[model samples]
Target: MMPSPYPLEKDLGMRYYASDSPGIGGRLRSSPEDFVVEELPLPISDPNGPYLICRLTKKNWELQQAVKEIAKHLGISHRRIAWAGTKDKNAVTTQFISIYDVTPEAVGLVRIKDILLEVVGRSQHPLSLGDLAGNRFDIVIRDCNPEELAKRVQAATEAVSAGVPNYYGLQRFGVVRPVTHIVGEEILKGNYEGAVVTYIGRTYPLETETAQRARRNFAETRDARAALADLPIQMTYERAMANHLVANPGDYAGALRVLPPKLLSLLVSAFQSYLFNCALSSRIDAGFSLTEPEVGDRLLFANGREDIVSSRNRQAALMQIRRGRCRIALFIPGSEPMASHGPMDEIMQDLMEKSGITAEDFERASRFVETKFAGTLRAISLSADVQADISGESVRLRFTLPPGHYATTVCREFMKADPYVMI
Candidate 1:
């Protein structure tokens, strides 16, 4: 196993790379255009539907913020806007969104800087997350070492083509402050107060000194009003939580509930993702091959059904994996009771025990967030048909990843640099 050199990555359970090649040292997203993402959405067809489907193209913009800007221009609540995927703010991203009760003329009239919204079609249903088939990425990495570049690219490409551990990217947690999982742990442990405190008061070194000072003051004094005075207006979500605390003292759960339901759900989901990362890494650390299953592994088929590898089906599962029929997957625990079936489940159970979490805790979280914490399966590994090109001191990668996969996971195998470089 090639352990990651970055400390932040290690903290997040992304501890190793599938490829061992000395990476072609480079940086990603030197500019917005350098990292392009085009969503492959599922078909949307309804000529006279209530929801207007618009293709949103933006450069260097956050999806939520961009949606809020569009909502402001349209004089509607941002809740009316829905998207399939949440895209990074630092890239050129084009994806579809559904705006309810809005016409194409109104959408066309509304515009923001570096943001293009076009009415593509109409849908009876509002778009939800994971509505896309996949996303195509055209990324350029700049300032790479030229010596032995081809050799390193060849090695990394081969490894990535075979498969790479499908760990969630840095963006799953806050890029500037990776405290989402920490907040989640607090939530699952039934410490709503700790969750609120962590969400509002935890400061990262990457954040500005003023932001850090504000958070520290809040942490030290537990004074929500004082924090409000120092907290930047741009810290909208944090400020909202702090304001809630000021109005209703000692209601940490209420403070958390003040956040957008989607954001609150994500805070808990991040913890599930972190556990999956750890289980994947532990599987590799136990000398198990990613694609090949042993007697106690779980197999996830393309159709979303699951089966356990057994003495009777181990060979069959191996053949199925080789033929692209299914992949090994790990479970993300939730409110529903899922009986332990295999080694993967055992790993998760151990993790839950160690973390002081249980199915009941997830039930409490589900009630608090108003989103079902029902469990799901994630592929343990992913492979992409990579196209690599080089010009002068840069390298470009073109590939498409299925919905829910991260392009940075592929890029990391090639670059193998600090996570901040990719961010």
Candidate 2:
């Protein structure tokens, strides 16, 4: 008999597959020829250039902090410096940042040791949000197979050439399913206070079924009621409704389409949480943590210095900056890709078939490959290097993914590893 599906467990399983395995055709460790890493540079500015744009490479620095440092050096506010998006701090990232109201003379004034600030190009208009196309990434892979490697490379190249689905990457939400659960719980308790608190506190756990149920309920409610109606409506309920409306403007028709009031509230809450989670994920990917102004110093930027932001601040910031246009793609690896086909492979195969995906889809999900390496600090080291020849050994892959997709979804089919870190 087939086992009853546990959504949470299934989610965890998918994560294991994506992170632990290599490729779909049993190519665990790549030989020299099989391993390949390439970076695609994204378009920053248009051809017409009078605008002072700089493409600098920073070694071991967070993108946001780099922006702030550059702003301070140039004697400009952080808001003035604009970039396409944020990059991970641990990895050496080369990106473009523009300083408006600065000339070629002033561009030369900024200096930082790790950061190399130069004028890539310039334009009359300042670089604003969503100003450029996607970023181009340069990646390096280690260990590869010359023969089979060619096929794998062809597959990856083809996939990217065809636009990959822009789903939210997992980094947007807390590891696994914490954000969903927290929002769910808050909605069910009718506790706007708790929901607000959780957004600020970042204290929600990943495995709360109650919270998940609440979130589901909220989604149902919003589906029912199109607008916020008054029947002795409290301020908290009104605010919650307002938040729901902002997060899900498209759902208004759907909310109105439903008839019952109870159902309407639930749907509104669900859509609200979804929007909130999406925004939160984007900010976190950009290196901001959750925080609350009311909490003051407890959850401020000062407290979230180590690449960890408060859930509250992250979610609130998301609400403030969300444009409902962000999209992401999560890459997960499977066992077949690692070349270790066993009983586990059969189980994963069944799951994949049921999910309407093939083994190839899992293998080619992302160009980045993650291998498990033994290290002193008990860390999950991510490298862009691919090891295709060594079919049995594990390797690490590092790539910058957009917000709202799960890294683990790529490795759940492989063995479980501790100390999984995504930066």
- Model 2: runs farther than 4 Å from truth? 1-51, 128-133, 136-166, 174-196, 204-419
Query: How many pairs collide in each candidate, listed in order?
Result: 0, 95
Best-fitting candidate, scored by TM-score: 1
Instruction: Tell how far residue 153 is off in model 2, in angstroms.
Output: 11
Least accurate stretch of 10 residues (summed lDDT) in model 2?
Answer: 373-382
How would you encode candidate 1's per-residue C-alpha lDDT over 1-423 as one tens digit per residue? 598988999899898899878999899999999999999989987878999999999999988889889999999999899999989889999999999998789998986999999888998899988999999999999999899999998888999899999999999988889899999989988899899889989999888999999999888888999988899999988899999989999998899988877888889999999999998888888888888898877788988888888999899999999998899998899998877878778988998899999899999988878888888899999899899999988999999999999999999999999888887
lDDT measured at residue 322 in model 2 versus the true structure, 0 to 100: 33
Residue 237 error, candidate 1, Å: 0.9
Model 1 RMSD in angstroms: 1.1
What TM-score number comes out for model 2? Answer: 0.39
Name the regions of candidate 1 deviating beyond 4 angstroms.
Answer: none
| Alpha-carbon local distance difference test for all models | 0.91, 0.37
With candidate 2 superimposed using the best TM-score fit, by how many Å does residue 262's alpha carbon deviate from the native?
Answer: 34
lDDT of 2 by residue, 1-423 (tens): 011133443232212121212333222212322221222334544646545677767776655567767878878776677665444444465666667767767768777887777777766666543344433333333334334455545443333222222222333333333354343334333444444334322323452554444444444453213323321232233335435544665443322322223222332223223333333333333332222111111211211121212444555533422332111211122324422223222433343355443434323221111212111000011112222222333233334332222233222222122213222
* Candidate 1 residue pairs in clash (backbone atoms < 3 Å): none
Please give each candidate's TM-score. Answer: 0.98, 0.39
The candidate maximizing lDDT is 1
